[model samples]
Structures are given as structure tokens and as C-alpha cells.
Target: MNLYRKVVLSLVIALPLSSLVSAQDAVKQLADKLQVMDTLLANFQQTIKDSQGAVLQQASGVLKVKRPRRFYWRTETPYEHLVVTDGKILWLHDLDLEQVSKQPFSADMDKAPALLLSGEIAEISKQYQVQALTSQQFVLSPRTDDGVFKQLTLEFRGASISGMILRDSLDQTTIIEFSSVRMNQPLADEIFQFTPPKGVDVINNEP
Candidate 1:
């Protein structure tokens, strides 16, 4: 599976050091919030809408993330699909099809919005221009054209990430609202490990 597509995955703020102090401060605060956690587990509701605001799809799921590139994501609505990465390999499983596809984890996955929580603060600053929209909201615009989304906005409610909005080049928007967020919680290592079920086809794409 194409990680970006499957994940619905989707900057440089410029200013004098002194003039940017407040912006920098906001960025730092958000970064600190993200970095304080080793693991995060949350329930999420995602909606995709077209430019005209017509609903295209909706899904609800659970997500687990471990720092430095490990995550388990499952969609429990309309159908069931699971994507797991153990910092080295990525697995995409389709329960209905009873098939699993595996590939070596690649750095590009870092661009996924969910993974940003595990990324370095300095790297985030370098990759996107950050603007504080409100005390609890921030807008990030990519520095390059390679990203999957045109821009992303993150909303925080007292240090807890509350929502994310991703707008792609096609003008389609994907909004994800998170709840039941548990941060820095101990997650089993097995959760990040994946083994194909009995009789399921396995396709390995690793190089």
C-alpha cells in the first residue's frame, strides 16, 4: 500500500530572532508538548470533504505511536484495515482480503501528520513555516512541494492535541478529531509487531 495514500497523510517561519520571539516561543511550546511523550494512544474520527463541503468519507479508528518511527493505525469503520510500522518495516493488512503487504520503512513516512508528533522540533521548524493562529491553534505550511498536503493545521486543548486539518492540492480536506488521548502511556511492544494470519497472502516489497 502507498503509505501516504493509505494514511491520508498529509515550513519556515522567517523573522528576526527578536521579532520572532513570540512565534518561536509558540513553536517551542508546541514542540515541548509533543516531545514530552514516548508513546501516544488515541481514538480518532476522520472526515474527508470536497471543496464544496460534500462529505466523501468518514472513518473512526484507534492510533498508537511510538517515538522515532513506530505506529499502529487501524480503521474500524466501513471496513477494517491496519497499518503497522515497527521502526524498520511497515505492514499493511486488509482484513477483508486476508492479505498483508510488507515493505521496508522509509524516511518519507515522517511527513505524515500523525508522525509529526514523534519528530524533532528543530526539523519541524526547518520543514514548515509555523504561524500561531491562536493560543491553541497553529498553522504549518510546507517549505517544499513534496508533501502530500498543501498545509496542515493543528489545534491543541491545554497541551493535548485536539484536531488536525489537512488540505491537499486538489482542494480536498481531511479533518481528524482526536479523543481519549493517552500520552506517554506504556504500550506493549507486541502491538507494533505484525504477523500475517493463517492462510493470508503475504507480499513483501522490501528491498
Candidate 2:
């Protein structure tokens, strides 16, 4: 699952910081951006590579996210799977294996990039240092070594997220590029849930 989430974006806002903007200002900027994105849907291409610059895996997927903790992510090829959450219960489904794993969206998962979309922005600001690389790009570095990834870079096309780069502690890198971007769009809540089909195994650990 680390590989799956390693590709998740660590996003914030990109603004002029020529005057050495303080952390508080950066956090506020990111909060405003997140607030505006009440919902987001997009097509994404994810690539995972090793430190040697060799490609390890690549896949395309659709991602839908609703504010205050609801998201649906599905990988369409090379290995079909989904990672979804209905705000409380998190689900990981492997279509190839016909299995689903369920658990609470716990504090641990908050350490992942998904927090940028679903968790509290104030809390997130506590964990990452945000820096604007350009007017359309920003980098987020985890304040602690314990974060799942070492560094994250996000690119935006005028408030709509366009790309992400996540580098883990091991130096492995994952790049994600977004297309067909839609923001503040209506997304039905039911899609964020996982329903087990006949013959699929379910491992439920959530209450």
C-alpha cells in the first residue's frame, strides 16, 4: 500500500514569497485553496521509479475527492485496484484478487498525502514546510522524518492541480500528472463507498 500512496499528492498553494513568507502565511494560503475545492475529479497518470532512474511501475487512474474526508481512487490498468474512503472507513480493493481490506481512517494514514485533501489543513500545516518554487509550483517538505515521503512537489494551473512529485525516504520517486481536471463539481457520495461483490473476500477491521 505504500507504493499506492507514495503517488498521492502533497499539495498546497503557490504564491510569491520573494519577501520570505512566513509559515503562517503559507498555511493560510493552502487553507484557502482547499476551502475552494469543495470537490475535485480528474484523470491521473502515475509513475513510480527507483533511485537508479529505472521505471518500476506506471498506471492511469480516475480520482474523485470531496471535502471533509471522502475520496475515490481507482487504478485502471497494469494492476486494477482501488483505495477509497467514506470519511471514516477506508477500503482497499484488489480487483485482480477479488479482495477488500477495510479499516478506520486512523491517525497513521493522516501522515500520508491524502491528508492534504481529507484531513485538517491546520494540522497538516504543522507537519509540512511549504515553499513556492514558482507562481504555479510549490514544494512541501515533511517537518519530521517520520512522514511517509521525504519531499513533495505540486504544480497547479491556476488553482487546479496539474501534477505532483513525491520522493520517499528511500529516494524512490513517484510522479503523478493530472488531466481532464474538474474542480468544485458535484460527486455522488455513494461512489466513495466499497461494496463487496459475490465471491470477493472482505477483511473488515472497522467498527
Candidate 3:
């Protein structure tokens, strides 16, 4: 997957609703839960599968987020790929290609569901209708068809987020399971910033 799409996919991670609670209740509950995660650090495993339940791709990474729209994602093991944004410029670095891409962070990028945990409580209610499958599991469906993701599911284990599943328009499913989740911990701002290395192809997509 293009790291951009994967980043966006990872953001809109709310899914399947069993509706034990009202939509309004779900939205409020989810918002309240996310609001508590001002700074989050976690290890994640991402699995992509086709509609037939055949696995297509698997990757493991570390995810970090801070309130007011800062994020850092790193894939280590199979390859090294990174996506970083500080609510300003966004960077994507691929070690195999020896390339890095940069672009200005726009309003659309701010709408990413990742911000839901870091900030933007109102946007959650505005963008999606949420229903509770259980007290700790919630499903969200976008209000419009423009979003690339069709539906999202978020699962919480105890007070920490444990898993998320996103299904896109193409019927491809991406499952993210988080481990070693640490929330509301002090994190240095520098973690969200990046500088391209001395010897790499730097692509400036910013206008």
C-alpha cells in the first residue's frame, strides 16, 4: 500500500456496529475515550487481506501521536518506511528506495481519524455516526461516500486501545492490532519532526 493511503487508512479506524447503545451515545462515549489519549505510543501490527480472507500484506510498526495533530509512524523489520507530520509539513521516507517525499499538511489531512484520538472531538460526531457494539467497542460509518474508508471499528481493552479495523471502498480490509500501548505520557515534540538524510532523493510535493 502507498504509505499515504495506509496512513489515511490507519486514521479512519472506527468498524462493525452491533448497536447496544444509541448512535449519539456511541459518539459521545468514543469522543470521551479518545479525548483522554493526548499523547499515545504503541506498537502495531497491520494486516491486509482480500475479500476472500486471503492475507495480502503484513507489517509491524511503532505509532506515536500527540495532540493538535502530530504523528510519527515507523515500519521496522521487513523494511523501513516512515510517515511523519507535525500539523505542518508531512514526510514519507522509504529506506529501500532511498527516497523521501514531503508535502504541506492541508485541511484534508487534518481530518484523518488519527486526530480523533489526539484532538478534534467535534469532527467525530460531524463526520460519522457511531454505534456501540459493547461498552468498549464502537463502529463508525461516514456520513458521506467521499471517504476512502467504508466503515471503521475501534476496540478498546481496558483503558487502552487494543485494535482497529478499516475496510475501504475496494473491499480490502486492514486490521491494526496495538500492543504495549502507552497513553498520555510525556513525549518530546521533536519526535514528530524529520529531516531528509544527506544522500537520498528528496521529492518536494509541497506547492
User: Which has the greatest TM-score?
Assistant: 3
Candidate 1 — which residues are off by over 4 angstroms?
A: 1-23
lDDT of each: 0.75, 0.74, 0.78
User: What ranking of all candidate models by lDDT puts the best one first?
Assistant: 3, 1, 2
lDDT of 3 by residue, 15-100 (tens): 45556466778888887788888889999898888888888778888999898778887888466888888878888888877989
Which residue pairs in model 2 clash with each other? none
Tell me the lDDT of candidate 2. Answer: 0.74
Model 2 C-alpha lDDT per residue in residues 1-207, reported as the tens digit of each score: 545433533211122334545656666666666677888899989888899989988888888988677878788876787888887788878887788878887655665764466666667667777876666776788777774688878788888889888887778888889999999887888988878788888998765
Quote the lDDT for 3 in model 3: 48
Scanning candidate 3 in windows of ten residues, the lowest lDDT window is 7-16
Task: List model 1 lDDT by residue over 1-207, tens digit each.
Answer: 433245442410022233478767767866876777788889989888888998888888898888867788888886687888887788888886788888887766666676676555568877776777687888877777874778889988886788899887788788889999988888888888998898999998877
Which order, best to worst by TM-score?
3, 1, 2
